[model samples]
Target: MTSERFDAVIVGAGFAGIGAAIQFKRMGIDDFVILDREDDLGGTWYVNHYPGLAVDVPTTTYSYFFEPNPNWSRLFATGDEIKQYCDDVADKYDVRRHIRFGVTVEGARWDDDAKLWRVGLADGTTLSARYLVTATGFLSQPRMPEIPGITEFAGRVIHTTAWDDSYDPGGERIAVIGTGATAVQLIPELAKTAGELTVYQRTPIWVAPKLDVRISERTKRVFARMPWTQRIIRAITDNIYETMINVGVVHYRVPFFRRLNISAMDLCKINQFIQVRDKDLRRRLTPDYDIGCKRPTFSNSYFRTFTKPHVHLQSDGIDHVTADGIVNTDGTKTVIDTLVLATGFDLWEANFPAIEVIGRDGRNLGKWWRENRFQAYQGVSMPSFPNYLSLASPYAFLGLNFFNTMEYQMRLMDRLFGELRHRGATTFEVTEQANTAYLDRMTELLGDSLWTLGNCASSRSYYFNPHGEPSLLRPMSTQDAITEASTFPLSDYSFV
Candidate 1:
């Protein structure tokens, strides 16, 4: 078996891993390696390339605050543009040299005697590092539906994650099996070309109108010349999204904020009413649960796509797939030439840990999270995982924009590692007391959030884990998260 050693090892080459590597470079820590199973970086941007794919959040707020892209073609950048941005950031930071593509990390275990982590690869090789960071994103794993006879379907099957660029569905009968954010983007595109399109939705989504517009070359040139102009735009966009989360979702218990949530719901209803003419179709598309129960999306064409004569909405759940069609729970069958599954990722079952992480005392991270609730100190460190950080851990995500989460995590890394350097420490682990305290505090704070108090039982959101706890989000404002990352007590960690 081959073995290599490094100062640190990152288990993903996505934006998060790239950010960690950048922070390490800033700390003058050069002896680190990044591993990714994919042939390239960009993470989700690299994986998802379905039709009509674009950033749901405004481009001004969706990117790294440190590295601004002035060349976005629109307010909502396309998937290709985001992927290019990832490439540009990695190139600019010179982290590409430290990255090893097409390497699958099977697991990592803490070597107590060695005081290092041993990361096992799929090729029967091992790499040891003083510090380990898992940046396997929250939406890394793709989930295929559990419907019976899916394999028996004789038509072409396509998951949005594994979209075939060459295959054109024009004039082809298509049956889509989701109404999530991905489906919301894809269904509209499919409707324009598909001969007959049937959408099978288990739960309806709350979609607001997309206020998207093209960015003129003049604006780009101005942003390039005066970057502060772009920063101001970013700030405005960020505040808008933050208010949506904090007031309409997190502070749902307050009467005023609850009223704001109602107003937002009304806005979505108005959007639907304006686009969809049929009352029955509008009612079928309307979500019974509150808005924040699921991750809401913004779209102008998704609702209107149903009004097309070629498009059909099927609310009856899937029963099974026949040889050439899908059988519905309502005793109906929809024959189709193509089956498109936008079922999204499996968060609780497959992605909480993403890989086998054996920490101190052989404690399996996945099993522990299942037995106990998914808990992490500041959503980065765990009690037994010394010198390790999980960037996409429970309660790590903040607001709607992922860049906000990455920004705070970058700050947390800076503080944590800065403390390590100050103490001349080789290893550090969060104290069990701190972990429990953080978990309790998060639980208490989430008591007022929409996920906890609002009607989410039928939302079927990935936000709620198997324990029925909405532990995915931090349930706090972006500023608070950033402040805590920088000001958290260093004594909460055991350094040695």
Candidate 2:
């Protein structure tokens, strides 16, 4: 087949890809295409439709800064609402025209000779583009547990990512194999109908009171009539989350922040104390690690669900799955009708690159990351990746809100591409010196974060990669990220 060509090829049709495309359009770089493996856009919002699914972060802070939605029904929007927001954003920005859904990108290699990137697709075709942006979010890949007899089980298996809406768990014995963020949201819904529900947890997640409230129609109208009113709310919500991360997690080493972190833990304990009356069950549910070790979630129902007579928490760890049920490490067994795997994504191994990325000189992006360390210049550019960007790179995610990261990246794109245009260059890449300097600075800053200073040995958080480095989040405030994205020395990148 003939190779399709474009000015840019974005390897995701999610929010990140849409953001990139919008930025490209603003920069007058219109010849770009968005490719997604799913049948439609919305990325995770499009894919995951499990019960009790909602935005963990507040609705005001979850959306793009430029495009505010005043129609959110609640402070914490449901998954369907978020998905609709994605659709609305895409439609409003006209990014839907650039999206090609159900298109799987296998890999991409830098064509040094042609000064472009050759993106390989699953259909045995190739796309040539001057710029390549991998917007595949960190949570794109769903991970299945490495159980002994999961396949042999004679029951319906459901992953949170691919939940079977047709299969009802009402009055059925059910087993959920994880207690991550997804499970925290889903378990309560399962408890309402399941005959006997068991949650097999390896690590306990810290839970906090969800201050969720319904957004009244009057409030939404005020937001719609006065967009600035919503922006103010967004700013307030944004700062609240920023403080939660910067003080509770990133700056844990500080004497003052350390006390605040302890207080935060206590708050979660108080939340659990009120919801869970059984002390022993509460002990089983309580996390031993510090609050920020793993991402904490907010829920009014998660803790109370375990207090139900039909619900059970199995913390001994799963040894294997039998044809009828799961066998625990303590030789205990729990027979169930359905198995729900909330086992989160494989971040380091499978999702770091998400797809094969061969940069200049045949440098395999994943292999290089494993051999050395995961590093990206400002979480976007790499040393060997000319005219390429990965939105989901190391140190890219900021605070608890993803929109903060996306907004800053959009700024970086504006500055970088503006420079490219000014220099009349066709390619740009981060200099080796610049890449190393940024990586070293990030490492130094992370030394003060809770992941390094706090007892995170048992957290089992995806924040720590295979190398045992907490590189997923940038150890700085959202303001710092924005400043760096705008003011970083242009000399850090080479234009050619």
Candidate 3:
């Protein structure tokens, strides 16, 4: 294979990847490639095209800082709307042409002698780059339920991650396993058309009403003409949302704040909660975990779907798949027409492809992670992975607007590049000692939170390790997390 090269290579053309490409253009680094497994540039929005799907975060606040769109039709835009927004950004910034779709990177090995990454593409294409940016969103890969006979099922089984246009839901008895975020959004959509929707909810979700309102045409035109007004609105809205997260999430991580946080919606009838005739269903749907323990969902019509006589929330844990459908642990077997795995994606390797990264001394990132837990300085770059940054790596997930997190990450990356140029540095990597200290600080801080040693039971998740500790997000507010990431002095890295 002939060797080719670029100044930078960005993985996964979602919000992060597209944002990075646009920033690279501003930095005068034009030779860069945006790689994704999908055939389009929307990333997560492209694949997760289920019905009734929309942004949990308010639309005005969940956008790029560089180019904020003041034309959102609703406060909470649908999945298609979000995808179109991403597409619009890609076109506006001229980043779409630079992206190569259906190209999965098999491995990325950093050559210590050459100070470049040896990237192996799935199509047997090998390329080298001076820098690497992993922009794969956290929810990229689908997590299929570990059930026996799932593969042996004679019927069609579709994961929400792999939703195709041809897979019709109308007139089909669908069994959607796992009532997490994906399941919550999909149930309302599927319930509308499916013959009978069997929602196999393992655990109930603490769902709040999605407060979506249509933006008036007059209001939109005004915001367009006076964009600074929109900016002010965005800023204020963002502050309010951040305050909520601080109260709900950051509060849960603290002792005294825990009780005061999660009970805000306990008695409120905000967005109109539906009165279910069945008392048993109401109790089964209620969640016991602190509001921030698991990811919270928002839907206008999720709970009300049970009112549809065809739709049923089966609380009984699915024991096994029989010939046609599933058998519950409670000995109830219902033969479904189809199986839809709305179970969420694996946060770690699925979102960030582990196979590609081969760092110093031919160290595979996956192997390294297996031996040692994922430790990073503010969840951006690992030690020895210089000239490389992750868009949504560990400790960088923002439950609010993911776009905010991407913007913050892109801003820091711009700063890193500026530092490199100032110091005349050809490469910038995290020092081993610096990474160790950062990791120690993060872990020690997390140990103090209610998330790690709180009343919540241990569940192996993106948030926890085998030791059952919170590692997905830093145990602090978004402002605090940014401050923590900024603590690593750029002067520590050496120039060429």
Please tell me which predicted candidate would have the highest lDDT against the true structure: 1
TM per model?
0.99, 0.99, 0.94
- Pairs of residues at least 3 apart in sequence or in different chains that clash in candidate 1: none
Query: Any residue pairs clashing in model 3, and if so which?
Result: 107-356, 108-356, 386-429
Model 1, runs deviating above 4 Å: none
lDDT for each candidate structure: 0.94, 0.93, 0.76
Q: Which stretches of candidate 2 lie above 4 Å from their native place?
A: none
Tens digits of per-residue lDDT for model 2, 1-496: 5378999999999899999999999999999999999999989998999999999999999999899999999999999999999999999989999999889999999999999999999999999999999999989999988899999999989999999889888899999999999999999998988899998889999999999999999999999999999999998999899898998889888999999999998999999999988889889988889988888999998999988899988888888889999999999889989999999999988998999999999999999998889999999988899999999999999978889999999999999999999999999999999999999999999999999999899999999999899999999999999999999999999999
Q: How many residue pairs clash per model?
A: 0, 0, 3
Cα miss at 118, model 3 (Å)?
0.8
lDDT-better candidate, 1 vs 2: 1
> What's model 2's TM-score?
0.99
What would the per-residue lDDT of candidate 1 be over residues 82-176, giving only the tens digit for each residue? Answer: 99999999999999999999999999999999999999999999999999999999999999999999999999999999999998988999999
